[model samples]
Target: MQLRLQQRLQERRQQSLYRQRLTLSSPQGAEVQIGTERLLCFCSNDYLGLANHPQVITSLQENAARYGVGSGASHLVVGHSGPHQELEEALAEFTGRPRALLFSSGYMANIGIMAALLKRGDAVFEDRLNHASLLDGGLLSGARLQRFRHNDTDHLKQLLQQRADVEGKLVATDGVFSMDGDSAPLGELATVCAEQGALLVVDDAHGFGVLGANGAGSLEQAGLSAREVPVLMGTLGKALGTGGAFVAGDEDLIEGLIQFARSYIYTTAIPPALVAATLVSLELLTTEAWRRPHLQQLIARFRAGAEQLGLPLMDSQSPIQPLLVGDADAALRLSEKLRSDGVLVSAIRPPTVHAGTARLRITLSAAHNEDQVDRLLDALQRHA
Candidate 1:
């Protein structure tokens, strides 16, 4: 087994698909310290730039002092605290849902939702480019998982038609595609779900706190209501700049999940102090409307610059801007070159993306100034 594992690892290295973690010596922001070097970072999911916000930090510290670090047990046991309950109430109100249940992470939320809602002979339709967690959830649910073309609602409609005979039908997709940085056709998908009598599940992990007028998420941005897209999941670790995730829906749905979702039932609840921080972040996400526009400005600047450089850029309006490099080795080389030029961006290779679509996953944050964006552009132009 060890020899086989070694051979597989060697194969990955040879194929330029081996992954590595950068040790950050400083807090997450537009600029980060890795070892002795400080690089202008364009690879974090801190879209609203609240990860290191002073207010958020203060809230966390104060709540930690009160809550005493850990929750001590699962939510059913003793973990659920005042902050957790308040956060859930806030999330439910923000998303315009009857109730919201928190989970330890986005993965656990997806898995628990699917496990509780789906079962044998059920049909779960997904987008080809859906996140790994959603796909894994469908598989673990013992459902017939069918993936249609990415963002192709017509194909999804056709699949739903074919599966019309299947009584238990659920359609799952990412509100925003993580790798490609494009949004799902929520309006069209909702229409298809309505016609097919399927439940629409949207994992807005990337879109929450980044899109919409009030930063409610992609559903709101796309003019979708709770009736149109029932199961809504969002994470605090992304645009909210904290940790944990939640699922929002009607009272019955949430009540059912509370009783049957094993992941939520068995796992320890997220730290109450972190939830306090998230509450502060959530307030900022809504009240500080300037952050989203500034992020858009930076995204537009980056996109325009990348386009002028004749780089292979995806059609993305979000902070996540991927530049297709085609080959894993070339992507890795480009990332290395950018790092050497005092820039930090991640090279996304196969398994994370399609085989020939390896690229640099450039993420922008509101914490970045225009000059910082220019620095990234200069680095890319110099290395390209």
Candidate 2:
């Protein structure tokens, strides 16, 4: 068994499908010292650049000093602290929902919502390109999972129509497609779900701190409401530059999750200090409109430059911009060339992306300036 497992892993490496980690010598920012090289990177999801903000770090330190580390138990136990409660309330308000529930990670939150709200006889519809966690949750829910074409609401509607004979239906999608770097057709999707009498779950992982007037997320960006879209899941990791994730909806939805979401109920809670840090990040993410606009400027700068160069850029208004290089080897080669040029952008290959559509997943951040964007463009132009 061990030999077979090792052989299969080696097959991944042979195909350039293996992923490796790089150690950062400092906090996430525009540039980082990876080993000995100070590479200008365009791969971090720290959209507003609050990962290293003084206020967030100071809050974490102060809270940790008072509360110490690990949450020590689950929220159902004695571990649910004041900071967690306050952050949850703030996030609920930010999302324009009646209530919100936090989980250790986006994956856990996705799993919890799907498993709690769905069951064997119900129908679950998902966008094919949704985050792996959402797909996993759909599968685990035993909800007769049927995936539509990426962002194809018509296809989703057709599937839901077919499944009208079933018990109930839940239609889930990533508000921002993870690898493709595109937005789901939320306006159409919301209407489809409403007409079909199905619940819509929007995982706004990539939109939480970058989209909408107040940076609420893609739901708000689409002018949708809790009554319209229902279940909303967003992460603190990407734009908020913190850890953990949450699901927000009505009071009933939250209370239902509390009673039945296995992922939330059984697991140990995340650290209280991390929650404190996230609270600070939430404040900055909400109040500092400049960071969001600056990030938009960076995205515009990067995209316009890439377009002028005729690079294969995807249709994305968000920070995640991918250049779809057809083969895994080609994507890896392009990434290596960029890295050698002292610019860092990760080569995204299957199964992170679809097998044939390997690419460089270039994520912009507020930490980067126009010059850095130009530097990346220069490298890409040469290699592309």
Candidate 3:
């Protein structure tokens, strides 16, 4: 086992597909400290820039003092605290759902939802470029997992028609593609699901707290409701600038998950302090309407600048703007060059993305200013 693992590691290095973690010595923000170097970062998902907000920190601290740090047990046990309940209620209200159930992470929430709702004879259809967690969930659910073309409603319709006899049908998609930053054709998917009697599940991890008039996520931005897209999952670690995830839906769904979702039943609940901080973050996410527009401005500025530099930019209106470099080695080289130029951008490679589509996944944040966006553009210009 050791020799085989070592060989695979060496092969990954040779192929320039090896992954490494960078040590950060400071809080998440537009600028990050890596060791002694302070870099202008463009790879964080803190879109609304509340991760390090003073009020959020204070909430965490105060909650910790009151409720302690760990949840101590699973939600079904003696673990779920006041902060957890409050956050779930707030999230349900924010998403306009009947109820919401919390999970340790988005991955867990996806896994639990699929496993609880699906079985050996059921069918799970997903977008080709859906997140790894969603794919894993389908596989684990013992269902017939079929992946349609990415964001192609026609392909999804054909698949649904082919599987028309299947009694339990669930269509799942990422509200926004994480790597490409493109939104799913949600309205079309919802319509198809409604017509076909299939349940539509949308994992809006990247869209929540970043899209919609009140930061209610992709469903809201696309004018979808709980009736249109029944199962809605979102993460607090991204735009809300906190940790954990939740699935919001009608009361029946939440009750069913509580009874059947193994991930939720087995694992310790998320930290109450974190949940407390997230509640504050949610308030800010909706009230501070300026953050979204400013983020859009930055995205536009970066896209325009990248276009002028002849960089390969993908079609993304979200904060995630990836510049496709095509080759893993080239992407890594460009990322290194940017690091050398005092900018921090990460190289995303297979199998996170498809082969030959390796790129620099540049994420913008509301914490960034016009000057910071220009700095990234300048670095890209120099490297391009």
Candidate 4:
């Protein structure tokens, strides 16, 4: 067994598919430190740059003094702290939902939502390019899972029509695709789901705290109400620069998740300090509206620069920009070149994406200034 495992690991390395982690000694920001080297970081999900904000850090510190570092138990037990409730309420109001429930992570929230809502005879239609968590949730639901082409509502509609015999139908998609950085055809998908009487689930982990005028996320951007999209999931660790995740919906859905979602029922609640820090970050997400526009500008600058340089850029309007390198080894080489140039961009390889579609996943953050973007462009030009 050990020999087989070793062979499989070696195969991954030979295919350039082995993954590694970097130890960050500094807080998450546009510039991060690894040991003594400060690299221009363009691979973080901190779109709005609230992760290292002074106010967010202060809130965490103060709340830790008040509530301690760990949540003592699960939310159903006694771990549902004041800050947890407060953050839930804030998120509900922000998303214009009747209620919201928190989870330890986006994966748990996605899994819990599917498990709570789906049954053995039900059907789940998902986008082919949906996040791994959403895909896993569909599989775990004991439902007949059908995957449609990326952002193709017609394909989803056809799948829904074919699955008409199922007891229940749920359609799930990522509001903003993480790797591709393109948005789902949310309005069209909602229309199809409505026509088919299928409940729509949207994971806006990459969109929340970044899109919309009020930073309410992709639903707001698409003019979708709670009625249009039933289950809305968002993570606090991305643009909010905090930790944990939440699902917002009408009262009944929240109540059902509370009752039937085993992932939520069995897991320890997220820390009060983290939740408190998220509250601060949430506040900043809404009130400080300039962050979104600044981020858009940065994305535009990067895209335009990449275009001029004739980089193999994907069609993405969001902060995530992929430079398609096709081969895993080539993508790794490009990433290493940028790293050697004091820039941090990760190479995303299969099976995170399809084979032969390996690319450099360069992410932008509002914490980054125009000059930093220029520096990234310069490095890409030199290395790519």
> What C-alpha lDDT do the candidate models reach, one value each?
0.94, 0.91, 0.94, 0.94
lDDT for model 3, please. 0.94
lDDT (10s digit) by residue, model 2, range 1-384? 999999999999999898899999978999988989999988998888999999999999999998899999999997898988998999998888888999999999999999899988998999999999999999999888899998888899899899888768999999998888889889999999999999999999998888998899898889998888989999999998889999998988999999999999998887999999999999987577799899899899989899899998989999999999989999999999999999999999988888899999999999899999999999998998
| lDDT string, candidate 4, 145-201, tens digits | 999999998888889989877769999999999999999999999999999999999
Which residue pairs show collisions in model 3? none
Off by over 4 Å in 1: none
Q: Going through the candidates in order, what is the number of backbone clashes in each?
A: 0, 0, 0, 0
- Candidate 4: the clashing residue pairs are none
Error of 3 at 378 (Å): 0.5
lDDT per residue as tens, model 1, 1-384: 999999999999999999988899999998899999999999999999999999999999999999989999999999999999999999999999999999999999999999999999999999999999999999999999999999888999999999888999999999989999999989989988999999999999999999998888899899999999999999999999999999999998899889989999999999999999999999997678899999999999999898899988999999999999999999999999999999999999998999999999999999999999999999998997
lDDT of 1 at 324: 91
State the displacement of the C-alpha of residue 186, model 4, in Å, after optimal TM-score superposition: 0.5
lDDT string, candidate 3, 236-262, tens digits: 999989999999999889999999999
| Steric clash pairs (candidate 1) | none
